[model samples]
Target: MTMKAKYQSVLDLGESLNIQNGSVTEENGVLKVKGTANTPYEKNILWDKIKEIGGESPSDILANITVADESVYHRHTVKSGETLGKIAKHYYGNAAKYQDIFKANSDILKNPDLIHPDQELIIPNL
Candidate 1:
């Protein structure tokens, strides 16, 4: 499929990417510990069960989660032979969202089928 055609039917599986933990593992001291149990209790003992398994702070772990790109308000330069439907799929991942793209770029895109190369168009994330 052409790049523009491929972009005309865009979609993303909202899956979170897993990042391997950056914890050290090795033999240390007399016992040669492989990994730390890291039990931080409220009173000298680790209480958060979630941390014991994940070994990362909530915010730090959440930061690694993959998220779809969302545009608030923006502009896009039309490449050769591109259509608003294609642009809609490129940004919103659904050709049905072409109306959204048209509404967003109405200032420049007077016709849904009329787009010119190198022309600037507005893009609004919905």
Candidate 2:
């Protein structure tokens, strides 16, 4: 199969995710994909899909996935019933690290327990 056909799923994923500056090219049976994902979570989704289709270590595909915002590890849009501790646990695997998230987003978050839906919080780098 041609490289284009082999990696069509990945290319489609880029489109679905609205990846910025995405480009795909095939040469000598190798596929090259480049794009910037809005968040680390988005980038991880792409990698997961690629690995799902191309195997754990596929040599035929080369992907250059970059996170658009490198300053913060990720940005989380608050949802109802979510707390800083829950968000911290999701990102850092430690509920005690909620203080880190609270400090990072002190401008908007007055209290670590008062996050409301639609509020965006910066998950600073560890």
Top candidate on lDDT is: 2
Q: List RMSD in Å for every model shown.
A: 17.0, 2.5
Best by TM-score: 2
Candidate 2, 64-83: lDDT as tens digits: 99999778878899999999
lDDT of each: 0.44, 0.88
Q: What overall lDDT, based on C-alpha atoms, would model 1 receive against the true structure? A: 0.44
TM-score of 1: 0.42
Give residue 27's lDDT in candidate 2 (0 to 100).
Answer: 74
Candidate 1 structure quality by residue, lDDT tens digits, 1-126: 332222211111111111122122222211110112211111111212224433554321222121223333346689997888888777667888888878877776687888899987766646
lDDT of 2 at 47: 92
